[model samples]
Target: MPRLVIVFDEFAEFKGRHPEESKRLIGIARQGRSLGVHLILATQNIEAAVDPEILQNSTFRICLRVGQAQDSLQMIGIPDAVNLARGRAYFRAQARQQFQGAYCGGPHGKRGESVSPRGIIWVRRDGARREINLPGWADGRGHGEPEPPQYTEAQAIVERIQQAARYLRIRRPALVWPDPLPPRLHLPEILARHFQGGWDGARWSVCRPLRAQARQIAEIQPLIGMCDDPARQQQVLLQLDPERGGHNLLMFGSAGTGKSTLLRTLVSAIAHTRSPDSAHIYVLDFGGSSALKPLESFPHVGAVVTRFEDERVVRLIRFIQDEVSRRDALLRREAVDNYRDLNARRAPSERLPAIFLIIDGFGEFKRLAPAELVRSVGALLGGGVAVGLHVIVSANLQADVPNAIFANIGLRLTFSQADQSEYFRIVGRPSEARLRQDIESPPPPGRGLLRGTPPLEFQAALPSRGDSDEEQATQLSLAAQAMSAAWKGPRPPKIRALPFLVTPTAMVEAAQSVAQTDRADLLVPLGLDFDTLTPLAVDLAEDGPGFLVAGTGPQSGKTTLLRTWVLGLGAQPSHDRLHFLFLDFHTRTLAAFRRLPHQNAYVGSAAGLDKALAALDEEVARRKAQLESMYEAADGDFDSGQVIRGWPHIMVVV
Candidate 1:
C-alpha cells in the first residue's frame, strides 16, 4: 500500500562492493513496479555497472557527463553526454531531450574560477613574454559553455518547502541515520516537553487545563520515556497505558544497561504528572538500594524496601496484597469493571490512587524469598492490574521469570543483551532487516528496543543532567524535594513499623476510649500488633484461667512481660480495683511494685512462697464461706447467684 523509492549514488562502486545486494536490486528493478517500489541508479560507467536485465526493465534513463562516448551511448543511445557542459544532461524516456540539472551546492562562480579560460603570460629571462591558454579555452559565448549562478537555488527551494511545511503543521522526515542518544537527558527537559508550562524559577507551573487533563489521563497511562521510531521517521513519547497496552511491564538486559535508570525515570514522571492522591509508588530494590533510594523523599512514594531488609520486604509484599484485595472489594461493591471506571464514578476525595510496584532485581527476589511469598506475588499479578496494581519488574534473564508472571506482562522493553541469541530470546526475531542489523550492533547504555507491532528502538531518559552517579543522585534528590514542596495535598498513608520499646504510660494513652471505666481495668496494654500497629493488650476478665510467660532463652522478655503486667496495672488510675501477689524468686523484678496499693503480697524467697500461698488459701476459704452463707440465705437456690460486694480482682505472678 505504501510506495518506496531506493536511490543509489555511484552505482559502480556500490555494485563492486556488494555484488549480492546489486543482484537483489536488479531483481527488484525487474518486478518492483507492480509492488510500488522504484529504483534510481547513477554512475559514470553505465556500460559496466548497469545489469542487462535492469537496463531492459528501466523505463527512464538520464546521463549527466561521461569520460568516453561509449558510456554516453550506453546510457541514452546517444553520444551527446560526452560533449554536454557541466550540470547539463540528456534525458531518455520515450524520446531524447537535453536539460540542465539543478545545482544544490554553493555559487557556481566559486567552482568555475579555477577552470576559467582567461589567458596568462609567462615572463622569460630575456624579458620576452609567452602567452598560454588553459583547457576548454573557448569564448564564454560558446554553445556548451558553463554558466555561473548568483545563489544556490536548491537551498532556496528547501527553505521555501520548510516554511510551507511549518505553516501546514507538518513534521519533516527524520534522518536515515540519526546521531546516538546523548548520555544524559535531564528530567526538566523531559518534563518541559511533555507538560505545557515553563518553570517559574522555583517549581513547574503547568497550564491548568493541561494539568487537569494530564491528571485524568495519567490515571490509566503515564509517559515513561522518549522513543525513536526510525521506521516512521519521527520521535514519540513512550507511554504505558494499561487500558490500551499491557498492564505489567518487563525489562531485561545485562548489567549497566539502564534498566534501573529507566525505573527511576518512570517514578519521577509519575510524581510530576499525578498527585499523591491519584498514584503511589512502592519500590523493592533487590539489585541495590542506591537506584531507588532517592525516590523515598517523594510524597507519592509510600515505601522503598531493599533486599537486605527481609522483614520490610515481607511487609511491603503483604501491603500490596492487602491493597489489591481492598480495591477488588471496592470494585465489586460499586459494580465497577475496573479501577478506571471506579475512579470515574467516585468523588475525587474518595478515589483510590493507582499503585505501581517496582521490583528492581526480580531474579534475586525469586531466589531469596520463600516460595509461598513468591506464589503470593504471582497471584497478585494475575488480577492486580484490574484493581490498579501494576508490577514493573526487571531481570537479568528471561529464564529467571516464571511463566505465570511473564504471561501477565503486556509490554516488554529489552536493553542490550550479552549476545544476539539473548536478544532474540527476549524480544523474538525482529521482522525488519534494519532492526536486525541495529540489534546486532553494540548499543550504548539506555539504548533499548520496545516490543510491539513494529518493535521500536528507544533511548531511555536519565533523570540527571550530569553523567556521574553522584550527580544523578543529587538531581533525583532535588527533584523529589521540589515535588514535595510544590504539593499541598494530603500525603500518602505511611506504613508504620512496630516500636522496639513501648512504655506503660504510652500504652495507656494509646488505649481506645471505652464507655465503661472498668473495661480499661480488665484490659492491659502490652505492645502494638503487627498488622494494624495498634495497641495489643490482654483481657484480664475474659482470658482465663491464667497467663504463662514463656521464652526460648534467658532474658527473652519473660521477666519483662511479668514486670510490664505488674507496672501496667499499677500505673492505671483504678489500681485499687485490682490486686496482685508477687512471687519473684530468681529476679526481684516485681519488688518495685511492692509499694503500690494494688500489691496484696510480695514474696521474694521459697519460704515466702509458702506464706503467699497460705494467704491466698485463706482468702479463697473466706470467699467460699461467704458464698455458702449467701446460698443458704437464698433458700438453697444455687441458680439465684449472690456474691460479696467490694471484692478486688487479684492477679499473681512468679
Candidate 2:
C-alpha cells in the first residue's frame, strides 16, 4: 500500500465535534491500504484531553505551525502554532520540511504581499519575485454592450483580487518569474540547487549545480528503493508541459519513487513566477500542512480561502456554481455567451481572472463529507472550465484520486509505483511509474511522474531535504520509533477519563438553538443526536480508533452537542481534560467555540479537516479503552472520575 501524508494540523481540536464523520473517514482510511487511501491528522491537543476510545489505535502526533502557549498546547503538546508567524507550518512527519516563511507565501496585498494563516506556497528557485504588466482579459462583455459584469458584493472581493494580480505583475518580467504555477508545476534543473542535500553523510543543496540525477546515493538512504539519480529525475521533468496538457493531473507512485521531490520542484518553480491573467492559480487545500504555503505570494491568488470540511468544499463548489452564473450574466450583459465575449470585455478592471484551483489529497475531503463524491468530481470535470475553476487533485490511492479527476482531465502523470493497477487507474493505461523498470526501485526522495505539454518521464531531486522529504516521511509506518517521538517541549501529561453528558433534551435544545446560533460547540450536534452519539463516546474512551458520522442530515446540532461535551469535560479542569478539542470544520463553529470559555482550542476549517476522520478514530480508541476498562459489561454512570473500568475518555460526533 502506498503510504499517504495525511495532514491533521487541527485534528485534535475538531475530532470530537463530528464523531460519526470522523469514524467513517477512519474506517475508509483503515481500509485505505487495500483501497489505496492514507489517513493522517494532528493529535497534539487531544492526546491526553480525550478518552482512549476516540483514538483506540492511534498513537502519533505531528506538530508544525503551532500557535501561542494555549495554541501550542493543542499542537506538538507545546502550544506552537501561536508563537510562529504566519509562515510557519508543522507536521508529524519530522523527516519532512518544518519551517515557515520558507514555504508559506505572503498574501497578495495592495503593497506587496503577506503570509496567509493556512496553505503552503512554493518558492521560486529563481530568487526574488519579478513583476510583469500584461494585457488583461475581457470580462465576457462586448465594449458596445450597455451592461457590464456585476461588481456584486460577493464578486467585489474577487474583483479586487483580480485587480491585485494585474497590478502586481504590471512591472515584472513575463516568465521573468513563473507562470502555470498551479495544477502541478515543475522546476527545471536551474532551481533545485538552492537547498542542501544529505543522507547519512552525503548531502547537497541547490547552490551547487546538480548533475543530471547524480548516478549514486551520497549521504542519506532513508527509505528503501529510493532513487537519487538527478538525471532520471530530470528526464521526468522533460515530460511536463506546465504551459499545457492536464491542468489537473495525477502522479501515482509507491514510496521513495521521487513523487514528492517532483511535486516540491513543481511548487518551487511556480513561486518565482506569476500568471499573466486571471484564473491563474488557487488551491483548495485538504492536507493541513504548509507545503503549498508559498503559493500565497504568487501573483495568481488574490486571496487565500482555507476550507477544512466537505461542507466548506461544497460551499466553494457552490460559490463556483454562482460564479458560473455570474459569468453567464456578464455574457448576457455584453450580448456574448462564450470566452470570445469575455475576451471582448478584457480591460484592466473589466475581466475576471482565470483561476487554477489546486487541491491535494482529493480523498480526504470525501472521507467524511456529506457531498456526493461523484457530483463534486463532475463539477470539476464538466463545468469547472466555464467558471474559471480548475482542479488538481492528489490522493494516496488511485481510487481516492476519483474518476472525475481522470475522466475530464486532459493531462496525466504517475510517480514510481510497482502496482500497475494503481497507475492504470490514474492515467487510463498501465502507468509508466508502475512500469518504470529503468529507474532504481527506490527512486530517490523527490523522484516521480509529471505530465504536461512536453510530458516528463524522470524524477526530481532537491539538493537539501525538500518538501518531498517531509511528504515521504509521512508514509513511514507509525510503528517506527521516530514516527511518534516526544517533542522538544515538556513531557505530555497523562490522559484522564471524560464522561458523556449530552441528554435527549440537550440534543433538542441544541437543535432548537440552531435557529439562533449554529449550535457549534455542544455535543449531539445542533442537528444530529441519537443513542450512538453519546453511548459511543463513552464506549470508545480507551483508544479504539473509532470514527463517527453525523449521518445524512445536516449535522445541525452536532457542532453544538460537541461543544457541550467539550465544555462538560473541560469543567473538570486539568491538562488531561485540556487534551481533547473540537477540530472546527470550515465553518463558523470555531468562532463560536472561541467565544465560549473552556475550549481547549479552536480549529476552524483551517487545518486537518481533510482527514478529520482519522482524528475521530483516535478519539474513538480512547473512548473504547475507557469503556473496556469498566466492568466486563455495561457500567452505570460513566463520568470523569468514575471509570467503568478505569480509563480516560471524551465523546465526539458530527
Q: Rate the local accuracy (lDDT) of all candidates.
A: 0.74, 0.44
List where candidate 1 sits over 4 angstroms from the true fold: 1-6, 9-38, 42-52, 59-187, 197-220, 229-234, 431-441, 464-472, 496-517, 628-646
lDDT of 1 by residue, 1-654 (tens): 557788888888778767787898888767878889899888766766876677788889888888888888887998878899999988888888787786677543443343334455776544489996433333422223343322454543354445445545666664685665554466657767566643333554432223445335433255667777766667766777765565788999888788898888888777766777778899889886457887899989998888877777788888888889888898899898888888878798888888888899889999998888878878988779789888899998888788887777878888877665665666666544435455566666687888765667777877656768788888778878887887778776666566778775677676653223444676777777787777777877666548888899997888888777777777777766788888887778778877996647888888878878988999989888887777777754465222432566788877
Per-model TM values vs. the true structure: 0.76, 0.34
Q: Which window of 10 residues has the lowest lDDT sum in candidate 1? A: 141-150
TM-score of 2: 0.34
Query: Superposing all C-alpha atoms, what RMSD in Å does each candidate have to the true structure?
Result: 9.2, 36.7
Error of 2 at 269 (Å): 4.3
Highest TM-score against the true fold, candidate: 1
RMSD, model 2, all Cα superposed?
36.7
